[model samples]
Target: MKRLLFLLKKEFRQIIRNPFMLRAIIGVPLLQMLILVPAVTFEIKRLDLAVADNDRSPDSRELISKLTGSLFFRSAAAPLNMADAEAMLFSGDADMVLVIPDDFSEGLAGITTPRLQVLVDAVNATQAMLGWSYLTSIVRDYNREVIMARGAATSAIPGISTSPRYWYNPTLNYKYFMLPGILVILIIAIGLMLAGLNLVKELETGTLEQINVTPVRRWELIVSKVIPFFIFGLLDLALGLGVGWIAFNIPFEGSLLLFFGCSAIFLLAVLGLALFLSTLASNRQQYLFVAFFFTMVFILMSGIFTPTESMPGWAQQFNWVNPVAYLMRINRMVMLKGAGFHDIARDVGMLTVLAIAFITLAIRAYRKRA
Candidate 1:
């Protein structure tokens, strides 16, 4: 216990004594959160729409007004013809073009279906799909209003109506969905860099040989080295959560102590992986390259930007081993869904298994020999 405590002191001293490392611990993640969180959103907003209205009737003008009034869409000048509308799409001036045929107003009065054509720029398929959905919803609402205004038989055919209640995030704010994921990324980054580089730095400076010659066993060194980084990981998590709550107004729906406890376990797994990586590299540069490669794989496969279910079967299977994925999943579930420990027992178990496996692997990988 005495030896481990002394080693922990040494590790903290090294981190505190170095200005660059201190800034990295504090500043890097802070800057990344401020810059990236707002930019990372899936919600489609402010799509430019061009109208080619051949009807030029009051009904047609009403439809155009509806489209322009929507928060997702903005009205650009009406194009002259299909050719001009095509040019607008080609020139990237319009994301969607709505064409109301000449008989649109007459068709409504005559009890006939009006012909309306929509040309959507599908360069970004997801954005295009969402934009089309918005347009269709507006048109459907206008159709309902028209039927009501004409005093038509409302109960002729009652279509199926759905009342969707979005829990936790009623407004569907993208930041609410993304902030927890970003916090996970930041902690993983800091834990990996610190643990991976710490041993290599000692090895490069010839102090590792001196420490190895002492009475410290391999497990003692590993535990001592990991303790400080584990604390750091907790500190990083606290900082991120504070910022997320204050700046982005992220909700804390679950128990804070439970969240922090799970985060600590997740950090143990991440820090252990970093220690294992450290055992493979002799210097900081080599560790960096190796760390970066694993970092990219971990982040990409962790379902931060994409859904795990959307990945290939093999990739989804691989996510079982990814601590970051589990942590990200659990954090969001807890925060957004207000899920309890019983709800996330399976994931929590997986993280515990990973934490033990990684720490064991890191212990085996570490060598006292030069």
Candidate 2:
């Protein structure tokens, strides 16, 4: 116990002596959270629209009015002809072009349905799909209004009206969904970078050899190293939560104690992975390359930017092994969904398994002979 405590003191003193490193440990993650939470949003907005109205009729004008009235769309300079509209699309001045036929009003009045052309720039596939959905919704509403005005006979089956209530995020604020995931990323980056670099630095500087010659047991050395980083990680997480609460107005819907408890377990797993990498790489450069490779894989496969359900079957299978994925799931579920331990039991179990696997491997690979 005395030996371990002395080693802990030595580790902390080394950390405190390097003021720049200390500041970087806390500052980098907080800065990234502030920048990325607002910048990385999935909500599509302000799509440019162009119109080529061949019919100067009331129905055509009404349709154009509806399109322009939406907050999602804005009208660009009107196109004079089909060729002109095509040119507008070619020049990237418009995301979509609305062309109303000359006989639109007559077609609406008679049995024939009015044919409207929507020329979309399908360059950005996501924006194109969302833009088409928005336009189709406007057209559907206009059609319903026209049918009601004409007193047309209703269908035998009554139409369904939907009243959607978005739980947790009523306004569908993208930040509310994104902030928790970003926090997970921040934690992992800090833990892995600091843990891997610290061990590798000792190896590079010949300090690790001196320690290896001492009376310290192998388990004692590992425990002492893990303890300080684990505490620092917890502190960083707490600071991040405070930032989220004050800056983003994020709610603390679940148990704070539970969140912290889970975070400690998750940190052990993350630090273990970093330490495991440190064991494999003999030099600082090799450790960095290995760290980056694993970190990149973890972040991309973690489903913070995209939904795992939307991924291909093989990708989803691989995501099961990703520790970051489990933590991301746990954090979001606890913070956003207000999920209890029972709800996140599966994720917790996976993390526990990962923690054991990584820490065991790291310990086994650490050679006193080396």
Candidate 3:
């Protein structure tokens, strides 16, 4: 135990002595919090819209008014024809286009269900989805209001209506949904880097041979290495959560202790994996390359930007092994959904299993050289 403390002190001094690595370990998390919190969002208001109104009638004008009245639409881009609209769309000048046929007003006056064409560029699929949904909703509301005013439901019939209660994202703001997930990423990156460097630094400096001959038990050495990086990971999570509150005004709707506890365990797994890779690789360069490769795979599967349910069957099955994915879902539930532990119990269980497995693998890899 005394030997292990000496080794832990050595690791601490190494990290403190390296200026560039120290800056990276601290700076990256802050920089990401400042820049990316805004960039990662699903709320898309003030979108550029275009109207090609051939109807040019009162009813048509009213429909256009409805579109313009929406808070989401920024302004209408002018286009003369379908070709012009197409050009505007491709040039990124317009996000949504509404083309009202010339007979739209006449058809509406005749109680005809006018076929209003809505054109959306799905390349930026998130905005396209929001625009389409908003358009459909506004049009539907207008139709209902018109029907009620005209006493269209004269029969002894009832109308069935529906309302949506968005659970996690009540405001539907993207950053509120993304900040917690982004924190998970930062912790994973930092944990991996720190873990990967620990043994390689000792090996590179020829200090590891001395430690190998010491009286320290194998488990003590491993725990000493992991404990420091695990704390580093927790620091990142704390900084990120703080920045989200101060900078972006993202709310915390669940127990902070519970969330941090889960995050710490997840980072334990990531740090262990990094140590495992460090054991496999003889040098820092190899560890960096290997760690970088797995980082990409883990983030891609983490469901930060995409839904895990949408992934291919094999890929989704594969992410069952990803700790980041577990954290992403659990953090979002805590932040956005205000979900209790019951909502994320399964995720918590999976993360615990992954942590145990990674720690076991890392210890096994360490002993193989014995």
Candidate 4:
């Protein structure tokens, strides 16, 4: 116990003495929370729209007013012809082109059904789809208005009106969804990269050999190495949570103790995996490359930016072994949904098992002679 304490002190001292580590421990989480929470989002807004209005009638003008009034669109150009509208799209000045026929008002007056043409730049598939959907919804609303103005009976239109209640997030703010996932990422970055690099640094400096020859047990040494990073990980979690609450007005619906406890378990598993990987790597560069590769896989598969359900069946099955995926789910459940321990028991159990398995592997992999 005394040796473990001493080694922990030494590790803390090493981190504190290094200026870069100090800045990284304190600054990286702050910057990521401020920058990434707003930047990494799927919510599309303010799409550039080009209009080709062949009819200068009141009805056509009313339709244009409705489209321009929407928050989703900004009128980028008013082209006289389809050729000019197409040119705007080609030059990337417009996201979509709306072509209103000369007979649009006539069709509305019961002569013929009006056909509206929408040409969207499909280079960015998501933006194009979302923009097109927004335009379609606006046109549908305009059509309904025209029918009402023509004295159509309300009973003639049969449709289901859905008032969707977004339970956890009422406003559907993207930051509320992203902050918890970003917190998970910050914890992973600190625990995995720093712990792995610390071990490799010891190897590079010949300190690992010195420690190996000492009276310290391998488990004690490993525990000591992990303890410092475990504390740092929890600190980062707290820092990120505070930032989320203050900067983004994010809610914390669950117990802080419960959230912190789960985060600690996650950090242990990450740190153990790092140490185990470091043992397989003889140099810092090798460990960094290996760590980066695994980090990308873990993050991309973790359902941080996208839903795991959208992934293929085989990839979803692979998430069962992914600690990041488990933790990411736990984070949203607890922080957003106010889920209790019982709600997160299965995931917590899996993480606990992973932590134990990884720590044991790390201890066994560490050669005392080396």
Candidate 5:
């Protein structure tokens, strides 16, 4: 126990001694949570729409009115010809162009499908899908209203109606879906980077070698190193979550204890990876490179910005090894999905496996070094 205390004391001293490194470890994450929480969004709103209303009929004019009335889309420009519409898209002036072809109303009159062409810029695929879907839905609704008012049920105009009930986010607010994932990412980035840098600093200043002569047991040394990072991670997690609830007004419907419990497991894996990297690196510069490399890979594959299921099979398999992947799912499930213990069991189990694996590898590395 005395040896454990010594190791713990030594680790804390090492952290306090390095000013820039310590600041970076704690400060960057806080700043990131502040900036990125608003930037990452799933909701597509106020999308710029250009229209090519060639029909020029009452029905087409009504269609334009519906487009302008949508909460998602705003008419950015007056109706243009097809050439000008395509030109506007080419010039990045619009996201979508609604081309009501000249024969559209005529087709409705001549007992045919009245085609409404939607020209979409798929560069931002998610937004494009949302915009087009909203447009289509509005047009469909308008068509039905026109048909019923005009008694066109006898006109035999076929239409499809839809009733959608959003599960968690009723208004499809981007903040609701985004805050949890951003918080998860901030915690991981902050925790792992800090832990790795802290561990590697001791090696750089020859502090680790000096301590090796002492009779400190391996587990004591490991736990001592992890405890500070664990606490720091816990604090960052708290601040991010608090901000999400207070500043952003995101929902906290699920168990807070469950969220923290999962965070604890992820922190173990991060600190373990840090310790393992410290064993491999002899100086601060090498540690930075190694730590940054892993951090980049971890963040990119975390599914905070993208879905893991959308990845190819090989990449999905790769994500299975990432601790943040599990954390990402767990965060969304808890905060957005309002999922209970039963729903997140798989995520918890995966994080457990990753924590054990990283810690085991770290222990092996530490033993080899000692």
Candidate 6:
């Protein structure tokens, strides 16, 4: 125990003495929280809309007014013809072009069904899909209003209505959804990068040879290396949470103790994985490359920016083995949904298993011989 404590002190001292690492420990979380949180968002707003008003009718003008009035769209310069509107789309000046037909008012009068033409630039598929969805919803609302007006004129009853109440997140703020996932990312990055490079750095400096000759047990050395980085991961988690609350007005709906406890287990898994990678590589550059490859795989597959449910079946199946995916789910549940241990029990169990597996591998892979 005393030997472990001494090694822990030595590791801490090494980290503290390095200025670049100290800055990275402090600055990475702050920068990612302030900059990346806002930049990495799925919400598309203020799409440019070009309208070709073939029908000078009041109803057509009203439809145009509805399109431009919403927060989703801004009206671009009116085009004289459909060709000009298509040209706007071709020139990348507009995201969507709305062509109001001549019989639009007649369709509203029940004389004919309106067939409006919508042209969208497909360069950005996500933007095009979302923009088209927004336009479709607005047109549907206008059609509903027309029906309601007719119903009132005929003294008939109104149609069925729906009032959606989003539980957990009432405002549907993207930050509320993103902050938890981003926090997980920060912890994973710090733990993985630091722990992954530790042994390689020591090997390069000939310190590993010195440590190998010491009276320190292998498990004690591994424990000492894991302890400091685990602490750093928790520190980063706290920093991210504070930033989320102060800067973004994000709420912590769950117990801080529960969140921290879960984070501790997750950090153990990440640190173990990092150390395992470290044991496989002889040099700093080799360790970095291996760590980066795994890191990219973990982040992309972890459902940080996109929903795992929406992904293909094979990808969702892979999440079962992904430590980041399990932790990401746990973080969201604990932070956003106020989940208890009962709620996240299975995920926490998986993380615990992973932590044990990784740490065991790392210990076995580490050679005491220089």
Better of 2 and 3 by lDDT: 2
lDDT per model, in order?
A: 0.89, 0.86, 0.83, 0.92, 0.79, 0.89
Model 5 residue runs over 4 Å out of place are 13-30, 55-59, 78-81, 102-115, 154-162, 213-218, 336-343, 367-370
TM-score, candidate number 3: 0.84
Residue 193 lDDT in candidate 5: 67
lDDT (C-alpha) at residue 114 in model 1: 80
lDDT of 6 by residue, 1-370 (tens): 9988888888899899999888999998999999978888889898999998887898898889999999999999988887788889999888899988888899888889888999999898999999999999999999878877777552455457799999998998898888888898898889888888887888888999998998778889888989999988899888888989899999788889999998899899888889889988989999999998988988899999889999999999988878989888988898889999999999999999999999998898889986
Candidate 2 displacement at residue 54 in angstroms? 2.9
Query: Runs in model 2 with CA error above 4 Å?
Result: 56-58, 83-91, 109-112, 149-158
Candidate 5 residue-wise lDDT at 304? 73
Q: Top model by lDDT, which number? A: 4
Q: Pick the winner on lDDT between candidates 2 and 4.
A: 4
- Which candidate would rank higher by TM-score, 2 or 6? 6
What C-alpha lDDT does candidate 5 achieve relative to the native structure? Answer: 0.79
TM-score list, all predictions = 0.91, 0.90, 0.84, 0.95, 0.83, 0.92
lDDT of 3 by residue, 1-370 (tens): 7777887897788778889767877787899998988886767787788989898887777777887888888666679999999998888899888888887876776656577888898998777888899989888878776667667873555667688987666766788877987898899878887778877777777777777776667677788889878877788788888888999898888989889989988988898888888888888888888888998889888899889999989989888899999999999888876778888999999999999999888887885242
Model 2 CA lDDT for position 366? 80
lDDT of 4: 0.92
Better model by TM-score, 3 or 4?
Answer: 4
Best TM-score goes to which candidate? 4
Candidate 6 Cα misplacement greater than 4 A, ranges: 103-113, 123-126, 144-157
Predictions ranked by lDDT, top down?
4, 1, 6, 2, 3, 5
Residue-wise C-alpha lDDT for candidate 1, range 69-102, written one tens digit per residue: 9999998878999999999999999999999989
Predicted structure 1: lDDT: 0.89
